[model samples]
Target: MITKNTNLFVVSNVTNLRSRVNKLYIPKTKSLLPLFEIVSNSIHAIFEKREIEDNYQGKIIIKLIRNGDESTLKELDFIDKYPVKSFEVSDNGIGLNRENFISFQEFDSEKKAKIGGKGIGRLVCLKLFSKMVVESIYTENGKFYSRNFEYKKNIKEGFDKYENPESEKTITGTTVILENFEIEYQKKAPKDLLDIARQIITHFQLYFIEKVIPEIIIRNQNDEEVNLLNLFKSEFESEILDDTFNIGNYEFKVYITKSFNSLSHKILYCAHERTVKDEGLSKYIEDLRYIIKDNDSLLGYHYQVFVLSKLLNEKVNEERTNFHFSDDEEGDSESDDDITLARIRRETLLKVEELLSSFLSKTRKEKVEQYIPIIQSEFPNYASVIEFNRDKVEKIPAGLTPKELDVKLYEIESEWKLEVKIEGIKLLDEKKDITSLEDYKKLYDKFWSEFNEVGKTDLARYVVHRRSVIDMLDKLIKWDSNQRFYNEDIIHSLFFPIKEDKDTVIHEKQNLWLLDERLTFNNLLASDKTFNQIRQLNSNSTDRIDLIIRQEEIFDKATLFSEDKFPNDSFTIVEFKKPYRNDYVLGDPKKDPVRQVRKYINEIIDKEIKSEGRSIEADKTTPFYCYIIADITSTLEYILREEMFTKMPDNIGYFRFYTSDELKYKAYVEVIPFKKVIKNAKERNKVLFDKLNIS
Candidate 1:
């Protein structure tokens, strides 16, 4: 009964299949591509059955069998998780007839064009699993028969056909078994059954909603099955959008659904009633607007929009997984339409981006509108803050709707006020001349504990303020080609203003953190003329070092620095020059910054400027760190090059000096470009900002 003819194309060369399979495209993040292949073939079989019989009960059952303990298994993104060992997908569809069997035996078979078969999906199966076991029953010449075969990467012998003499009629069904997963599939394999099932539902949302729906069931080893269609229907919300897009007589259907119990929002492109390509909607959201916040119902909103069109289908590449819009594939369209595929793809992407951006903007605006009144009602004191900064609030970020701008303005204003109110109070209290570090520590702990809400606001406020400062500094440095020079006094005050009494700095610690985080330690902090009294009684002139900063901890009873390359035990000197200042780059006849700082170093070593009877440690051999920051003029570059000042990574320069004294004093000098410090500090702080969830 099982007869073969010229239509049954047999490959004598197995190496051709190997060569073709190697040229296939595979996605890395999604582990469902292989299963999608098998399932797609099953769907095609179901479609073939529908062609034969009007009322066809098409069922695709997928079983995920595990070798290890199921309880120990978790989600793929979860910390404690492992891949499943095996899987079995069976379908009640039209069996392998002569044409289907011939299609199977040959590579790139064209038998399933009615169901959008690419003829190369089977190769994806081999890529994921070690081998595929196929069993099918078909009627040939009105006689019942079964075909059993194993399709591995490379097989020498072909399938063995068996005749079912007991039954004259064929049982219409096919079963595809995939097991013994190799390392490639096992590495990124989905471990949680439900999570993958949800991904499948999203991936094939348009497929399930098609006219002839196929029931796909995913089950675990325990026989707990999840009917994907039922899950989708029960949690389905109202349709977000349903409309047709027409471009030059080439029309595409754009349908969107918002549903509950879903993890992600996706934009899937389907051609011929099958999902050919997909990407997360959150990706586009992040690329264009703000990220979908991670919350409960507010964040977990699931959406899927399908773009169905023959134009897109024709552009689909050989793999059918991606569109063929490359430059090489252009100028050869035999269709009556003359528009290029790349142009269509570009127009489609732009249109999709614009539509999604509009949708998100409107939706977020509505949410913000609802939330604004509640925030206003709860925080009555916010009005004064909002009123005071009305001008700043009015100037919102571009592209935001009026309502979105209102909500953002409220958040911005409220946070600024709370930060200032809390920080200002703390500064006022600290100015009362606390006698000891112990008292200051107690006050610090009390402030944080008492103003817990403001503490949270301050964390974000610090990042926002630091980011602004950096941007402001950038503008000052690179504002015009004329090389405008900002006032040095203005720059100093922009960072901090020394209390006229020289007690402490008051411009918020974030600016200090920008300079060097060590500058933020409340211990012995003074800026500009605050330290006028601390100047050394040198030979002739008077020029004080910009900053005397170091890390100290009363609790540790020792220096807080670790035993690394250079500890923070020594007194540190930092000098900042205006970006336009060329004086520091002068030669020996002029005032050299190196000698200026060396003078400060010598003064600190010899004079012993006291701090409450405890002087800064300075034996002859005590190490000192000096940092000079300015624009890299020619003389400074020459000095650095001649002094063997090795350039460390990230535009940092280092030079060491050992005065050949009896005690051999040590000095570590670092001269860095002001722009590099500003840029690197801002960039590095971005990680901390993200970690802290700061705006």
Candidate 2:
């Protein structure tokens, strides 16, 4: 009786009117984050049903599969009636009856729902697969009813249809099957199903641990139950949240884990209220999405922080929320409001910083010390350039791309041919005697002794009782010697890169060295080495220049001035210095050797090389001069300002290096510009292009 648009004011069937606008269908994007959110919602759905029914303790089983008979088959394999990729999520919590099932069919654009709001989670199943069949049971009117939704032709005929049968079932739970879906990343040979299983176990480990020991069995292509838990054990323990704090009426749960080598401090778990959506760092990170709120509510904008410390000094504020941590002791008392949320962000960050410091102080520093030998023995070429010291701790600089720097790190460390291997005793039975407390003491003593000798400054005795350390090391040796014996000479190694050439060029700083010591360059040379690895590590005037012999490479500091003559092809000469331990300590040009080398290189190129009638012609010679500092630390910066040179030679090179600890601490390097080296475009560009054409 009513045409398509004739009776638009009908109020009796308003549900269908709203449903038409909401469009209870799936989005056409491939993202595992949404899948994760869906599963998370289902997990809570069961729990919420239990809570509503006053069911205190119940179990929910969730399964993910990639292949099946009625699978969401990829379009390419549709004829075979076989699914190339499929997944299943089944739960045993309170099942959905007629109302819940129909409610699941609703989609909220504004994300306003009493139950997990945005019931579009169901559509996520559809997004990941072609057709999803939800088998659910509901206990209402003193009877249990079973129903499902399958793909069928819609009334329009062009769109897919939703078809299912209603029946009665004795069980009280739900099973969802997604069929005929193509994995955007993998279509034919999809990613291992175990990966999805592992993710389910990992991201929701706490959820399972607090409730049930999830009976997760992953099957290989052969269909045998593969042991997914064993592989997940290492990560599961690390993800467990053992720390708790509070802020702004929200309860914060925190978990922090350091890398086995003790170089990284990561936040494994951080959440607030009953959900991970509203408070701490969300899975979806952006400039605007700062505060995680329940049901997509906005809490704050950009609320994350990190801090470092050398020792424990104060009580961490357990009550503060919505903040981050900073170990800059000088700025602790400063207002947090200066950064973002100001007072709240600052104080919360201070507490987290203090917590981390306390944790670090209590932890033994010897874990990272053992890697030095592995690096030296494994990557002889670049190992000598990097120096890792356990006594030093370098925090990240204030800026962006710290994580991008990590990506560049793996390339360099891998190219450098470094490996991670352990030296000393073997394992016997289920335990390793080499890990005994006594052996730890011995290694500890040996470490500090070397530290004192090389650093020339004995640490405070109270740091670790020397006598106690001797006794511990003695016990360790005796225990491991009597047990499984692994020769100490057989050291383990982990291969890392020195320079990895990728397609994209990252610009950052370079650590230069003019001092008489080798230095690590990862922290400072992300952009510098990236340019070099990409054959772009030169100024505008001389890309063909090679054999960059430095004073530290040839004659030590004392004899550097004696060599006034440099090779004709030595295109660049750069000098640099390691920054002071205390970054705030302004550099003294008189003491810092970088300025001296830069000056010497300039004089040699300007007075000696340029005077010899060297031409920019292909037959003639060219060289440049530059200097690099270990960091932008205050000391090195101070020297740059104090020495104050307006210009430098056209044909010289300069660069700096990073501390070994800082280099290996992260995985990537930042790019730094050599603006000073290419100041004279016309002359320099001519020389560079000429060299390029010659090459």
Q: Cα-based RMSD of the predictions, in order? A: 21.6, 24.6
Please, what is the TM-score per model? 0.44, 0.36
lDDT of 2 by residue, 594-678 (tens): 4343333333334322212333211123323333423344554454455452222332222333223422111111111122212
Candidate 1 off by > 4 Å: 1-13, 16-28, 68-83, 111-117, 154-169, 236-240, 245-252, 257-269, 275-304, 309-359, 362-695
Q: Clash totals for all models, in order?
A: 0, 88
What is each predicted model's overall lDDT from 0 to 1? 0.61, 0.36
- lDDT value, residue 359 of candidate 2: 36
Best by TM-score: 1
Error of 2 at 139 (Å): 1.7
Model 1 lDDT, residue 317, Cα: 60
Clashing pairs in 1: none
Q: State the weakest 10-residue window (summed lDDT) of model 2.
A: 488-497
**Tens-digit lDDT string for candidate 1 (1-695):** 13233234333334455555667767656556778778877888888888888766889999886667656533323422446767788888888767787677666676654345767677877776777777777666666566656676654332323332323445677888886776766777778877778667765666766645599999866666789888777554243456565667888777776543345666677777766777665553433223344344364456566777887778776556677554554454444456564444444455555556666565555554554464353333334444454444433444555456547766776676577677758667666667999887876764454355445545655565676677777776654566677765556555555322234444353265655666565344334432445432222324455666544543222444455533334555667667756654434623466766677666556654555555555656465667777677776777667656777676554455645565335677777676777876767798854554332
